[model samples]
Target: MLTGALSSRMSSSVSSSDRIFPPSSFGSFESPGIRASSCFSGPNADMNEYDETDLFSISWNQDYGCFAAGTSHGFHIYNCEPFKEIFRRELKNGGFKFVEMLFRCNILALVGAAANSSYPPNKVLIWDDHQSRSIAEFTFRSEVHGVKLRRDGIVIVLKHKIYVYNFMDLKLLHQIETLANPRGLCCLSHHSNTFVLACPGLHKGQVRVEHFGLNVTKLINAHDSQIACFMLTMDGLLLATASVKGTLIRIFNTMDGSRLQEVRRGVNRAEINSIALSPNVQWLAASSDKGTVHIFSLKVRVSGLDSITHPNSPQGPALFHQNSSTSIDPLVSPNTGANPNSLLSFMRGILRKYFSSEWSFAQLHLPGNTQFIVAFGSLNSVMIVGMDGSFYKCSFDPVHGGEMVQQEYVRFLR
Candidate 1:
């Protein structure tokens, strides 16, 4: 049996005055469960003040040590390492509500409601960090609810379909239609070119997995209530689903739709608004409405095999009736042989029953209820977007922490 280490760490230091500011105490921890302050003192410090209600989404840029956030008013880009705003942009229509940054490029896909309307816009703008200009604008008719950019530049989870586009050219390549209205969509490329899609149904709250252009392989009744978010491992082996009713996260196998584990959290009954997986697929972190983020470690083990021979074969010489005209009989014993693999499987099941245990949960403060989280950096640091339009950077340590730790701190300014 394989076991993972668990440890909790809180932020090191924060002033009483600064503690009131949620974003100031972000990175004061060396382990899990750390609560740090969110403070910024740099060129864009003046932009740090924002209305608590206007924040929508946040993202971190690993290459530049910066973070970008979207709000009702527009978007703000900040320096994570220095805790300062490098640039700020106010949209013309005041509806730049959602923002997602590409992992490999400085490109940002911004989505939000259109002017004078309660609903979001049909088009999305892609902005380049270097020029700070809208490089490409994509138009959709049904309203763009969510958008995710892969390394190859595929955007997923549109209003009622999935769209794959060229990252460099923003050219449409393929589309997958859905039976139910999709709340969210996740994709994992298994063999570089082929990928699996996980889509959450809005009405049924069910989850489905299918290969690109292939038939659905796995389907499960995922949540009782609406599914707020879902995530898939990079290798497309595991799936995690979270609901709005409770802090219960269920993980499933991608191959046969087997329930691998269930994680129940004792924190507030907040909707799991966002989820992110580490690059190595060892850790999973989720942000909820309770103003906290929870992290869990995933461990996988394969079983061993056994070998055995049949015991029912005639082992010794038996007296036959052919020797004499008199009555003679042949005796036989009941067969007790079993398939070696079957026996090995039964033993392995017993071993798992004795050694395997349910997964544990650890809570970490993310300053506030976050709408989104993205894993960036070559080290795969966590970046969360608070509902108040603040951005934070969190990392994990495999040794003493709960698989992942919040190693540093950075707060985004307006």
Candidate 2:
């Protein structure tokens, strides 16, 4: 049972599973329940005007129907339907490069975009939208790149490490070191008791996955190049991973490092921007530097898919690999293969170089080789945001695959 050292105090009798989360940093700790309501909160009175010069990041809250765009003037919240700007707030001493909202509510985590700013670059301010003020904050020793808030805990991502804190008062719970991750790549499972964390391993092409509550950690040699992107199902039972090569994507069982399914986007190597899983686990979506988004069906039961994914197939869920233990050993081989330098490995690598990967069941190519972030909405709809500041609401059918149809589009900037 490998475990991360808790920077905070550890109880003498706390079990391994429960020891990861410690008591509150404050005197009292209460689990904060989610209250979903939509509002664009800001202190500014001008909704029609914004300083576009400092604009760098835009994030759409799929569940809230509102998105936040960061700028030198602080951040603005916009309603997607009418495409109206609802809230505006400006930072007095510095600017934000990343602003993360908690659902549709006013609660937000603000991170400084620069090395020298009004606030420390490594600090996070958890704000309350209704009150139009910050209620709490968590400071780190290094610049903070990403922040994820869950009902039970908050996960903060620095360039080289991840910090898990109890959600209510922001007490330090656990800390895990990762490789060079400047983009802050990590995810959390809100639908289950499980907390999933993915970070670079000791070697390239390897990823470490920790199932927090289950006390299970697995090292998956998931790709050839450095891992580019990854996502977990709502229930945390499956994982989808992509490498920097942007060629092959894989679906794995989280309980054990079992490679379940693999999909290819193209043969030519490209930079994959993001990969997402649908709400139902029936669809997998990906977007890359090629300015295209592809959604593939994950329904293993379909006739032509594969025997294991077939409806009546006798194979049970993939067996947890023999190397399912907690260590992140680079040389530990998984149960899927025996020889790392076998003839089959050589041929597979050759085939990959020539044939590329398989095409998605459905795909959409944008106007240019635009970089974008992908998020799912209700009823088979996906929201795409391009680096050039173009946004599109596209819809597709999962049962009978077809080209994604654009429902609505807005260009925030030209």
Candidate 3:
């Protein structure tokens, strides 16, 4: 009834394309759809982005939320969150050539070979974070194999003999004769003022545990080959020992000195160079001559010990007992086995589970084919030192199903 111009203007203007695909229809198509590939992808897609270089050693400073690294040139300090370098210092003392750094209670201890000398005199330098200069320096006759800071800040040097000193005063406290040349020393924090020494002798390795002046336990012929490294948990509940022949890593009960589990890696013989224990006492890590690091979880099993005290229980403390009159094997003698409530049975269960699983190794390229030292610090960080003037800092993520699957895939490919 209306005129053509008036009716056309009154109707809504619309294009042919709009009529074919209306706004309502386009809205339905705009809804996002899930892709199968995106749904199934793993979380490690970005892991390969970071270049893994020849890391010399890595240590974490819990107080500062940072970690320190010692390399061939000098030391690098990095923030832990994003792993960014905050500071780097070039060593005027010929770099960290064949050296190792130990961080204890905000004190940085540097142990390494001196410059220009083929047989570098083992040197220990301690630096406090608050102060710019080194606070203490101790020289050793032999190359320092290992260094440990005790609870009271006493620095223990494991050379041919064990030397204890008040780090603050640089005063010598005790010197104990060792059964073998000590390769490793660890302070047992939980066991009433005790420490354990790992000595790898020409014949066999030995583990000696002492509390103050009293020797609590000693294991002779502990390892078939030379004992290369050892570690004790913070609580002194578990002890891990590795031999020169890296095939076997034995975990023991610190209380009664009984084997809990024996973890082995590789079918052929490999030399275990260093070892470290996790902060939670949940994991034990070992590095071998083959340039591989192996980690294992602790699965403890506890059963009551047999409630019978052996005849040897009455033999006035096993450490001081005179064996001249007794024709008994000290290890098998009743006196040595008299801890009815020692909880050795429960420890053995934990070891059994640890050894049952086949371990997977993570290969690392070190600076040289040098013997490397390893230590577990705050957080999930590990520091390693190669003989050839290189230090590496390695960080680990907790194992998950995806990681296990990936590890298996890599193993199968090899």
- Tens-place lDDT digits, model 1, residues 57-150: 5655433356667665566666555456666654323536567766545577766655513224555556565544444555555566666665
Query: In order, what is each prediction's RMSD in angstroms?
Result: 19.3, 10.7, 25.3
For model 1 the TM-score comes to: 0.60
- The number of the candidate with the highest TM-score is 2
Residue 391, candidate 1: Cα error in Å is: 4.4
Candidate number with the higher TM-score (1 or 3): 1
What's the TM for model 3? Answer: 0.56
lDDT of 3 at 241: 82
lDDT of 3: 0.46
Model 2 agreement with the true structure over 314-358: per-residue lDDT tens digits: 643442332222222111113333222234444775564433233
- Model 2 residue 43 CA deviation in Å: 5.2
**Who wins the lDDT comparison?**
2
Writing each residue's lDDT as its tens digit, candidate 3 over 137-179 gives 5555456555555444444445456666644444566665564
Between candidates 2 and 3, name the one with more favorable TM-score: 2
- Which model, 2 or 3, shows the larger lDDT? 2
